[model samples]
Target: MPLSSPVPRALRHTRAIEVEAFARDDGLWDLDARITDVKVRDVTLASGVRTGGTYLHNLHLRITINRELTIVDAEAASDAVPYPGYCDTIAPAYKKLIGLSLMKGFRLGVKERLSGVLGCTHLSELAQILPTAAIQAYANDVIQTRDGAGHDPLPDKPFQIDKCHALRAEGPAVAVYYPRWVAKAVPG
Candidate 1:
């Protein structure tokens, strides 16, 4: 974890609607920002990765501003990240196992969509839309779902963003998350 810094007490509060307003008023409805510090967490059952019958992977992408973007450092909260269910352990060697091409595609697509939707011409414009909640919601659909039947995993639904944060500084930080599925069956 980085140094424990505190987030600003308050700034302009903007919900999805207000964010939309900012984007529209600023003519920045097609901007996507880069996602950094991306970490992948795997949720396994007691049966283990190959025998568990189901595995869930959550990709959390964290980024800090490198340009004229505002960043509000919020006190890191333990409960902020929610898990639908308990996870046995975070997998190791996931990157080597998942491959780079797929990772690049996923990250690139996310950045493109974000930049396109926000239309952030400058880093500041992108900063306003930082601290974006609902990123998890958006990821729900990006993750692949595996059924342990040797069939390919596919997206089950549309992605939605669950959380958003905004910081006004020369550079701002943001995080986006998505889920992926892995599964296998053990012979009883």
Candidate 2:
């Protein structure tokens, strides 16, 4: 077992979310997200129940997507939770994520599919982070293959030349990757 960190005080509880990227032999990437809510000291629930060193919410979510970031598979499990029955209530609906692509409008899609009464709040929150992590995990190979080099694990796609100050068409990256869109020098 690894050595534990120093103990904390006044820390009634902790909410830890961990996301891990994994490579599979079948050419798909797997992203695992785990959420844990732990209380350091004994606490009383609103129902007059007392518990300590217990998990308020322990959720594990797995998402498998291909190079194009289309969801190939998804599964979720609740090992423990403050209310176990409520935990599984919204899990089944996450399967709707299949065939959905992770792109610019993906966040809204997540909201539509797994928000409010449609899905588990904690699980939905964790699933929201998978798209970015999946892009980082799966796109490195694609970028390297197509560009002949990995450019920060992502290729320049959309900037519209005026999205932000640093990303202006005159920015260094745009000047190199999208020279045609670069802002021309002004004559004094």
Candidate 3:
């Protein structure tokens, strides 16, 4: 369903975040993400004046992970920014993500290593989405998360069974699509 029409409003600013996943020939996966912020009207900043339709901030981040979802390499770049020298210098700090697993406490690990002064606010925020983006990218292609099958020793439930409202083990969607994981009624 689409959102209903609302009172007329003028455009002010736009922020776009894009994430793309690619499978490397070497059996790894690359998740590339970019964030761009644009203002509809000219804005003055501490640095200088940014003209209308120009990018206020444009940043890029990429992480390479193996089938296990462990990041083997990470990098970030700031093509356009409010503070050029300062903002772009923080790109190297993202390397600390190399050893982290996207599926295991990735957000917390990112916070511990790159929060506040240690990292760029925008890049850090962009890193937060990689985990789910990777999952969505690898859904059935690199990893089989759907039917609860294909593993040497299958888990009691699929990884996505209770992760969302539509997939809740006790929900109707689960009863129809993932019947094997439907929650059993408790004996009263």
- TM-score of each prediction: 0.15, 0.72, 0.93
Q: Best lDDT goes to which candidate?
A: 3
Q: Order the candidates by TM-score, highest first.
A: 3, 2, 1
Worst 10 residues of 1 by lDDT: 72-81
Q: Please write out the lDDT profile of model 2 over residues 1-188, one tens digit for every residue.
A: 98888777476778999988888899888889999988887777753443677787889898888877888888888887666566666666888788788765777888998898888888888988887677566543643312212333225544234656765866886676655556787998
TM-score of 2: 0.72
Question: After superposition on all CA atoms, what RMSD does each candidate show versus the true structure?
Answer: 23.7, 6.2, 2.6
Model 1: how far residue 32 lies from native, Å: 17
lDDT-better candidate, 2 vs 3: 3
Residue 172, model 2, lDDT: 83
- Could you give candidate 1's per-residue lDDT for residues 2-22 as a string of tens digits? 978778764322212112111
- All models: lDDT? 0.26, 0.74, 0.90
Off by over 4 Å in 3: 148-156
Report the Cα lDDT for residue 150, model 3. Answer: 44
